[model samples]
Target: MKPMRSIILVVLLTLGLFMLSSCTRTDAPSESHSIAPSQSTDNTNDTPSATARISFVSAGNEAGFYSVEEYDGHGIVAYIDYATQTQLPLCGRPECRHSDSSCTAYALVENMSIPVLAVINDKLVIMQTEVGSDTLPHISIADLDGSNPQLLCELDSNISISPQLYTDGANLYALATVYSGSGSHLELYRFSLKDGSYESLCSFADGVNGMITSCFDMSLTLMFTRIDEESGSVEDYAQVFHVDTNTLDDPVISLTGVSEEAYTIYNSTLITLDTKDALTATMTFTDLRTGSSVEYKTNALLSASGMNSATLNVFDLWDGWYRITLNGDGKFASFNVNPVTGEFFPMTLYYEDSMNVVLIFAESGNNLLVRAGWDETRDGTTLTNLKPIYALISKDDYLHSVPNYTYIEGLDL
Candidate 1:
């Protein structure tokens, strides 16, 4: 009986030892393991499915107007819907005097839309006009939806002509001509949308010719060609002026021997073409704040003639480059320019008659809204009608567009 009891005790001791060994192994791992307090707390709340929120707005058309022609020999403003390939009429009755025999016929010969459309603080300001006498040249200012097209202002009676209208974020600038005994002389004016006031900035005695053109803002400055009327030649001279919207002063400074049909400004740099050979002569970047200038010459990507009939517009794409559009031959071609190197490369090519193109930049230029024209497919080359194309190029090289939002991102909204 003593031996049997001893055996049972031994067996019990072995079982206890086995259980103790297992418990020891488990406790050793817990003691050796060291988890940081922060990590342990984070593990309690950290979600494995966390992600960032993103949304996008469709791009609006930059080229708002297309073919302005008269149908049946009557003056008509053909507003094309590029996305849908539809046409809308402006005013075609005889009361408007838009007939074939009329001197001011809607020839559609030069259907140039505003080079840039701006949305200032949510107000859609596009440059548009109506068929009327030169004495009463009518301009239109409406919301982005083309509603409330109030007769914002009229051209100066002295000029009796409608020069091309250019707008910055706040003001619209125009170039008009008045006939003097010798000839017609060019004049520049600024129209304030805030107060419906027109202020003359510069007027020269036939020295400056052609339509006055500008990019960005008059505050940034404007570029115009000075011509010698006697020779009917461009003097290879240009003028750059600082328009103080805050004051009514003549802001004209002489920039000699720089004749380019079209140009644009980026980071205070002026990229212009010298019509000498239809090439981009030299890129002159002027720092407005510092009053400093830098010049560089690069190989011509597109010819000056190609740029002329074709709307050549440049926009800075936050990533230290420019997206350029050459809207000629009833087609659209996009190219990218390296701001640092002045190198250009073809980006995208689409068939459309781009009358005008504007870039809408927000957040100091992080995002972009590109608007242009797309004409109706007629003969595989020519666009029978004009329409609009809105392109939104994302920072990640993604592009999106809508049917008729010609201008976006900056206006009043």
Candidate 2:
């Protein structure tokens, strides 16, 4: 009886090992769908466990060409080539009008396989996390094409519970949510990319949840939302903090207001979107350095019935243009807002399907990198089929002529 019991246990262990192996295979699809990059020739494009935080960077060797990361979220992070429609470099929307033929799509990092959080300074920042594991995620750096992998640092266990890493120029910052028997709070820390040394910059007490939204124009900003147990409702208010990159400790300016829909920092000005009602909204531009602010109110935001339930959020701020996205009901749309004048203009996108999913990646002058997706007409909350596609669109074409007037065909995601 003892020998029989031992044999049964052995067989079960063997079966478990095989199941785990099957689940860990690379996600790259068939060769027909995969683009094999020069540096990464391997096929491993599994769907990302999370969304990829991507940024655009120059390939250095190629003139007028740039690259961005395409990740399945957990397994594969690759660099893909991006170029203007013409052979020469065009920066502005008026100049870089790429049709299907003008822009080229090629793989840059396909052979490599890893999950990364950011692409900065021509390098990939990888984060390794495990479930219920006491060990903190080990951070590693890799080349733009997923080459030359190097370990940066293992974050402190106390601060790495749920860490969000960000970089500005050469410095790295981590925003982590830490909890204790008393309650949960948020901590902001700075890490040296060169050696991975870190220091706690500030802490927000009673912060149940928070996010480090933007680090631009030599400033870092964080948003925090606290919950009240007695009310059994999230507080209508939120806290926003701003600090200069050079001076992280000395003085931190705080702003309190209604929870923000979206925010961006440009030229030291922090612009926030605050929706008032169905037909109206306010955009507040506060100078992070000076604390001076100017608010612009618009009535064209809400629907006619005044029953609009859509949520308006600030997507990305580039140059002088701020991308504001509206999502609700069944459709989504993106508008480019001029922060100085409070002018809103629509960027007409040719929706392949009407599921209303849109993502604005980056902007070069007037050209916007956009990814649009849709799920088969919803049967309540369940979608039958899902489709995502990527493209480059010029703001001028949509503003001057007609929305959806010009569309660039490229990779299908």
For residues 181-299, could you state the per-residue lDDT of candidate 1 as single tens digits?
Answer: 77677567666655567766777566455433233333323344455646644432234555543332243333334333334443345445333222344545555446676564433
Structural similarity to truth (TM-score) of each candidate: 0.47, 0.58
lDDT scores of the candidates, listed in order:
0.37, 0.41
Candidate 1 deviant stretches above 4 angstroms:
1-135, 140-149, 156-171, 210-220, 229-234, 245-267, 272-284, 291-319, 323-335, 341-345, 348-413
Candidate 2: tens digits of C-alpha lDDT, residues 370-393: 444432446788864443344455
Q: Candidate 2 lDDT (Cα, whole model)?
A: 0.41
* Model 1, global lDDT: 0.37
Which ten-residue region of model 1 has the weakest summed lDDT? 14-23
